[model samples]
Target: MSRLLSKLSGGQPVASAPVSVDAHSLDPQRSAEMLAGFEAADIGWFWESDAAGRLTYLTDSAIAAIGAERDALIGSELTQFLATGDSDDLDSTSRPLKFRLASRSPISRLNVTVQTSQSKEIWWEISATPRRDANGEFAGFHGTARDITKSLAQSRDSERAAQFDSLTGLANRLRMARKLDQTLTAFKKSKRSCAIMLLDLDRFKKVNDTLGHPAGDELLKQVATRIKKLLGDHGEIGRLGGDEFQILLPDMDDRGDLGDLSKRLVQMLSQPYSVEGSRAIIGCSIGIAVAPYDGIESSELVKAADLALYAAKDAGRGTYRFYSSELSQNADWRQRIEDDLRDALTQQQFLIQYQPIVDAKTHKIASLEALLRWEHPERGRVSPADFIPVAEELGIINKIGEWVLEEVCTQLSKCPPEVRAAVNVSPIQFASEDFYDTVDAILNKTGVDPARVELEITESVFVGDLERTLKLFKKLKKRGVRLSLDDFGTGYSSLSYLRDAPFDKIKIDQSFVRGCSADDNNNSALVSAIVSMARALKMETVAEGIETKDELAMVKGHGATHLQGYLFSGPISIDELLDRFDSKELEFKPRGPEKYRAERRTEFRKIGVIHGDSRYNVFLRNLSKTGARIEGLLDVPVGTDLVLDLGDGQLAVATVRRSEGFSQGVEFETKLISDGDRGLCTRHRVSPYQIEAAGRPLGALTNSAVAAYTTGSQSVPRAFVEVDMNAYNRR
Candidate 1:
């Protein structure tokens, strides 16, 4: 190479016009040998430069093959094309040829992608050696380059095909599995958390069935685009076959964030899609699982997520659910609970607290309603919703009911003479033939006035033998004990039962009180109707479960004669009641929420707050429709936007309205709504974090090799490996 360049430069290094072959500079045999070597080896082209690194020589055939005129590239530096190479690709590992030339090092099989005259990339394998002048000073270089574009392109295409989905341009199942497994393993050692979301398009089958699979595929691609845009650069999404997708959010265990992201996903995907010039609508359900919390491994985490997904679907679709160990329990657990409930009263797990029912007219305590509480030895305080049905189904409610009556009578005998006690009777226990005698004996034994006791009955008693039920009611009323219906609208609500039965009071169910202030709600009207009917029957009316100021105002304006719920007071322990009774404060004051915007729910659950790429563990102390108070973060800035991960997949985007040490009050970007079961949910949410945990490709997928199907091109994409549905089904 040095001998050839020396001849081309004529010993003294000087910039000169590039010439193919100068017969005058070389011997005939040598020139013929060089030409033959070029033809025989099929080396693409060669160039020589002076010490100034200016192109002094160029091969005629190479210049023509590159779609370039000889004059244009002749005087240009060889590094001109290096600038236009794949320099913008962050993953590129190729050492640039320009740097090697600057170092005056020998270039050995260096690959450089350069643009041809026609604006096409032509990859070349370049090799060069520095030539020396007669004095052995550095002159220039002579090297050979061969086009390797085809081979390189083939290799990249194969790799992309193996890893990416051809349809949606998202990560395929194999890639997602590998990525998730790798991520969990790393996160586990650091004790960091990761959250994964499993979602499938709702009504996707109907789309396929009605519009055909092609349209479904198009809709899916659009869905992918929308999700990618929503997540932007925050997450990685993978298509795990059919309409199912898996999302890997690294370093995120905040269910609140995941839930918000899920809601956003459902809402976005559920929006009407214009496919094939026709409008189509669809929705989605999401299940979320976190690493180290749900599972340590990818498969276990995925299974947990799948269970949550089924739960979300079971919750009537278009929602998200977080995986919990409770979701894994079976029927055997219920049986065990039933057995435990039978022993609850005997084992001393039973306790009673009282909530006062106040007279609406004078705001004085009319009666204290006894509410049963059960604390399992192993399970702490068991919710009535969890154990009451078990007792009823096992026929243990009769003993439990009789014990509550006896216990309440004994306690009420010591209260002020005017103070009354109310005990709720289960329909099953109420129907027992000896139940009346037990109540009679308890009242006699305790020496408590029967007139001071109120027995709350449900409409369920009227289900069997109405004549006997009406007769039993009359017998009970004759005993001088007051009777009032409890949970009025929840059971077999029959006005005829009221007409014949001598009920002292009619209690309206709490369900009618909630949201009664809404413009479209009919609860106010229903409350008024019940109040009017009770008035005509000469029975007083009690509004039950009044929890909020709005509800209190609504029920009061509607003419309820009495009220009972948390607004006046929750169930107070016997000690607290004794203190109140001793103080002669039977007249309870409404000390509930004075502010209309007080915390809707005060919570202590740990959640996540994300600012930038950093997620801070915070306690969700209070949450409301438009704002939340988060603790555990120190000195957060006011006016900063943060995402709160409220567990499962619930995520709320909030801006810190007030900030102090370890606490921040934030206003939500979008207000939350009731999930129909007292839980709050974002209007649209899903977990999204700032970290590129799936290495960006999982969240940001726009690989061109698989772009044919994913890009917004009108043409059909090229071939890809097909999934055999028959074989897949067998598996």
Candidate 2:
């Protein structure tokens, strides 16, 4: 009874009321009465166990709580109802109460949760001391158990609240960091891999600015739900803060699978969300990094992923990029391009190129797509694909877009009445409040008929306020200009878009047209369906990127009205376009490749070619995933094995497939992977740590210095004659 008093007031909450009285010095009868009152109130239950650890004595209230007959429980083990089955980590945190009973040691304030046969959950804080028989031998034990369920739950909730985001109910940054560290540390020893993705909503600030913060918060909640649904149990997702999210997928090393997953995430997250009874659409960019390849440590991996994210955003949003060693070197180049774009804007160094869209049946010129170019004096013709996103971020895309409209109109004004011009519109430029006025001003200044100017709008334009977009399209159409949906079947495409959009044409994106007729895939069927839909909508369908005769035939047979691709003609200068028009030769014929070859790419660059133990400089005339052509080595047999060092930690083992004079074609032992920028790369790289073991400071890999670490080659007699391609070119 004295032991019971030591615990009831041992700073634990009482089931009913507090017992402040110290009964340690009280008479035995008074203590017994107090304990009896506790049992009657059901505040706690008392039980006794024999030396064998079997229950011997229990109160009526405790017996009822056990949900069993007294005879059944009297000889049962006390630990049987302790809920040990409910937890695996419990035994590691503290000594099992049953073990203490066997050792006859006293237990003070040990809390555990238990479930009865009836499945009732109860938390108990128990205190016990062993007793001795008259001969001083172990006899039995007595303990006091009290209900502490309420307090325990409150404490746990507080702890969990600290680790989770209140808005999204996901792990916070601190918890995610700890989780990543622990997983990476454990997986490193096991030689396993994990992939992490860092992503954030693109143009999310615009949502917060246009809509209220409450709508933004609701949008974030919807985003979290969408991500959780898509990922399911495949990965752990956390909301770092704001619109940023992180995902950790275990046992994932295959970059191909990672790329597919990243693509899905970007697409799913970019879908429109309903916020406060209004439709809100936003896009996302994702960056991926795999463990032991990108980095073994959590911090290093995170930094790599962050850099990739920046690259993806810089490339234009709604895309995903995987981390590569080249990204570190490209940081300065990215900034330089941004600065160049700004210069091009101020210096008016931009130029427009025109690609002809020909009628599918007549093969006559239908219209010309005005492609923007930045002709840098030193860098040659800079690609708009690489810099247009930068211009948008710099808030100069609207100005450039305005300039494009004016220039296109002015050029068309001098051309024949039937020669039409189609101009690409940036989503940022299209969303501006004064965009309509700018178009009106351009048309008035150029004196070109509105019918001759066709504005090509991508599906991304649907991302803005739907009502506003509808009104804007109608307003533009009311001015007698034609609207064409460009890049259809990409970026937030929905059938609902066509039901209301006032478009005269639908341009199938180049991606679908690339391999439509080559493979037994759905691309062909998709193009057919799109053409059928366009026909039903009384709109012309232009199959873009028909770079082969087969793709052209397939789309034309599917009832496409127009075709635009290199198969017809590549983009041309204004002077070249005017000359062709003056010559009155508008009909184009079939050209370009006979069929699509996805692996092959024509690349002219200097690469390191190694035969036996010697490495020599060679000119790589063409490159592919499985093979490449080199012009440097002579007298090499058709079956000779060589190593091609493609730089940036990429080494390919190859065998000569064809050899003649100074030119040889070699087939690779393994296929190369995409470096996330339409470039080839190796799946794995030589560990810099291995070089450190050979007596060097550890750092990132340099292909030239790390060749020994990769191939383990030593100096030996050169087996093939070497050729200096740079000097040979002069001949």
Backbone clash numbers for all candidates listed: 27, 0
Q: Output candidate 1 Cα RMSD.
A: 20.7
lDDT tens readout by residue for model 1, 283-324:
788888777656767888898888778657645466787775
Expressed as tens digits, the lDDT of each residue in 333-365 for candidate 2 is 778888788778678789889999999998889
**For model 1, what is the C-alpha lDDT against the true structure?**
0.73
Model 1, runs deviating above 4 Å: 1-326, 329-340, 375-380, 431-433, 464-468, 514-522, 547-553, 575-583, 682-731
Local error of candidate 2 at 390, Å?
A: 1.6
